[model samples]
Target chain A: MNNETEIRKWLEDVMDPEIPVLSLVDLGVVGDIELKEGSVFVEIRPTFVGCPATTQMKYDIESLLHAKGFDDVHVDISYKSPWNSDMITDKGREALRKFGFAPPPKGNLIDDIDVLEHVECPQCGGTNTELQNPFGPTLCRSIHYCHDCKEAFQQFKPMN
Target chain B: MNKTALKELLFKIADDQLILGHRNSEWTGLGPILEEDIAFSSMAQDKIGHSYAMYQILEELGEGDPDQVAFFRKAEEFHNSQLVELPIGEYSFSLIRHFLYDHSDFLRFDMLRNSSYELLAQVSSKIRSELKYHTMHARTWVKKLGTATDDSISRLQNDLDALMPYALGLFEKSPYEEEIISENIFGGEEELRSRWLELIAPIISKTELVLPDPEGVEPVMGGRIGKHTEYLQPLIDEMTEVMRIDPDAEW
Candidate 1:
């Protein structure tokens, strides 16, 4: 496997501490990973300026690489370009589904869709949900109450 | 406030943030746990960023570039209150500091959001949005640690006791006190302090932590006039090392 492919696989197992089903890569927080001269440089942006998961994400990345014999790993935190929901990949959406959290609803009329469009439930596949609060498990998510399931789950907000 | 007084007031607000942010950042790699480490580090970064934004406004008013204002100022020339300059004694202590300052800052920025100065008002609005998350992040840890095991609760209490005096320093009235408030440049510092106390009282009560009596504690001074603790020098040195290597280089 190419180095990028190998690192991607290792990163897939690095789950977010708050959201067990979602890995850092899946959340699209891991913006870019470059390996140069046997050293790994990983660029990441937190869900917000003060998201608590940033430190753990760095440590987990370092440890994961170290365990895989890539001893020299560096994690660079950047806030130049803010994080947005569009960054989350297709595979990440699938992972979220498998983990029992609903993936964001499919785009319909992409041009005029509001950023706060309703998120479908991964469990019962219900659209009868409302945001309970903007702040959720982490800074990037919002608390949504599924009217159908009557369950409160954290959903990633589309950062503008 | 006269222009000089306004400049001094801005400096105090800017310098305090710059130094406190630097101290909190030391926890980046060293926090006890992964989740907390990230959280603390991010808070530190936000503080610095807020400082930078404020300093930029100062620069526009011809104070100097943000870097020089942040890095090159003499220790005595810094206006940050004593609270932000103190060491981050322990994780629990740091959390207490965060708890107090985040609430205070939220109120401060909220007041600034309505400043008569349009530029300052816009900047305040942006900073206020970011402060909300900082408050939440700090509140989460404070609640968790305050109600956790016996050891955790005790540590937090002790830290709160030790830091309360310094916390009052954050509201020290600068030379421009009257003019700023009278002109509605920003709200009065005394009022801000009272509101901060009110906001934090419930949180402190919920966490089972003692709310330090604001009346009895004499507010520490001089950070508003650029006087700082011994810890600030090395912090400034390290933070500015890269910028100083080539002052004119684009970061």
Candidate 2:
């Protein structure tokens, strides 16, 4: 029953349904984990309120914990605070770039002169890239094209 | 007292988001610029996600599964406004529609944040934050393109004029509008329309685009009661293409 570190280790493998390269831990969506009286309670904050993946993520977490023999598991969907792209760990950013999607800039888009002007191409590492679209295939992504590689890629959008 | 009325209200709002999200998604890979392609896709996903959230609320009140409710419904069964169902035509038309629809869309969410229905209120509070980005994106484009070059301004203005009637369809009142209002599930449509006008007018004024005379234009109605244009069914068919192929398949 004293498998707290093992539980955390198990949770680390739970990937974000949308961006599969990043885990819930890497995305910073997993908040507090508490165990009491043989019951485990975990809090997860969604990337967006309407994210469909949030529902699946909850189910995945619960099932994973259940498979681990933690029968009394409670997954609380927390809306007390919103998730920001900035919460994405440096490792998560590298994973995103490695997946061929440009990771969102570290800080807010408001700090930049132009939101599109500065993104480095994930494919060719080119700063001389053009913004193809400020919006992309998903709510958290935008499309960019690199002049060097001439490849069209998606960038995880910078969230405010 | 009338649960049906509340369901109708929810259905229309959900349907509008779903249909428009589909339309916005069509811009993926086809946008004039790649950034816009992604932008439309992002908003499309957000809108569809919002619709799915609303559908889940409906399921709590005894509707079918969200996937079936969204993907299996016929065009005639849909309650989305005509504005949303229309093809995402030129970039100007889509942009103008986004500008027009999202402004009212946020206002509706703002009103629903205080809904007497606990679920709707909870959903609204969560959704409103996401929608702020939508409105910001819409407004920024409307302002940027609306004032840019002579060609851009003229194109945007033409779109504004053309889409006015359809845009007004957004406020077509529910048959249970009074019931919903009486129960505090929503503020009335007239109230939302007025607030929408007040909010959008100044922003539109800032652009070279002129606001169409609201008094003279006739709002296209019927979407609130499930009547849609010829376009909706085909769009629905396209959206459900994969679902129809294998309803049991994991999307």
Candidate 3:
């Protein structure tokens, strides 16, 4: 139970409430796991400063550990490590695509916001998509239209 | 480490975000287009989130509960600039206001990244990144509409000219400005205003929109000192209506 790798493996089952297909670990928000004395402590980073799902994610983490017979569990929402799209694992990006959302282009957005206009279509894998709105239904998502697929979709926005 | 000075600064910044966020949220389901509906709503969430963080920081400093401070405060108690409290009169006016407001907001937070107040600095750094998207959104629309047609350009220009004095009020000096700067808690409003002007000029220049000459504009002041226009109190009252039903009710 004290195995950090094993604990992270278990965390892969904790899916984001908004995007049920992706796990919190793969989402790159789960920060650290530590077994101190008889308790397990975890740190989770926030993708957006005001992301409402963060609270639900915390609850899900705690519930997952408690069901595993861990009597004492502590989960802290931290800003220390900071979550970025670059941290989203390759497995996570595939999950986003499967979920019909464009994965953010892999780069620090601090250097280029213009990349929003060029997202690949999750459905058709086309680069002719147009960014309809940089803001979306959620804080971390951007609305885009894929001319190839003739459909509107969302992207997990690139952030550094 | 002047707590009074720090709280004063935090209150004003937080108030600005909360007030503007409320205004932004008013566009939910009412935007001219679906994309605009989503943009305003999303930005509203980010701004309110930023204000909530500021309130939390204030709470950690031994103030009232964040909600209490946010919902219960009178209009006079709020330190947000007069610019934010004005009604979202028209889409053009709203767009013009957003352009002017977000530039200053972005620069203020960017400068706050170097604050001697570690927590504020950390929060500022995080908030600044999110604000980049907002500023980007504003700049894109302004440039697009500002040069689109004579009709569009005229509407945006009039609004921009009308809003200039009020926008300048965003940098109204706090009484604690001396201590705030001396303690390195912030780069003062004067410095921020200069930087904001420098940053916004290029964006405005790219568009056909005409920026008002600052020297002739009499800067609207007094919002930072709790004096406000008739527009503000009604806004505070409307926002607090639900919370007033049961102020102590636990969510």
On DockQ, the candidate that comes out on top is: 3
Off by over 4 Å in 3: A1-3
What docking grade applies to model 1?
incorrect
Error of 1 at A154 (Å): 9.6
Put down candidate 1 lDDT per residue, A1-160, tens digits, no spaces: 3497678778989988777878888788887789998889888866654465678899998998898888799997654454555667898788877776655544432222233345777678787876554444445555577899888676655543
Docking class of 2: acceptable
Model 3: which docking level applies?
medium
- Writing each residue's lDDT as its tens digit, candidate 2 over A1-160 gives 5666667778989999988888998887887788898898888877776576888899999999998888999998764454777888888888998999888787656334376665899988988887765555656666677788888888887764
User: Tens digits of per-residue lDDT for model 3 on B1-251?
Assistant: 99999999999999999999999999999998988888889989999999999999999899899888999989999999999999998889888899999999999999999999888887787788889899998988999999899999999999998999999999999899999999999999999999989999988999997789888899999999898999999999999999898887889
lDDT of 1: 0.75
Best by lDDT: 3
Per-residue lDDT for B9-121 in model 2, tens only? 89999999999999998998898986677678788888988898789889978999998899898888898999999998899999999999998998999899888887788
DockQ of each: 0.07, 0.34, 0.68
Interface RMSD of 1: 7.9
* Model 1, runs deviating above 4 Å: A1-160, B249-251
List residue ranges in candidate 2 displaced over 4 A.
Answer: A1-28, A31-43, A50-56, A71-138, A141-160, B249-251
Candidate 3: give its CA RMSD in angstroms.
1.5
Tell me the TM-score of model 2: 0.79
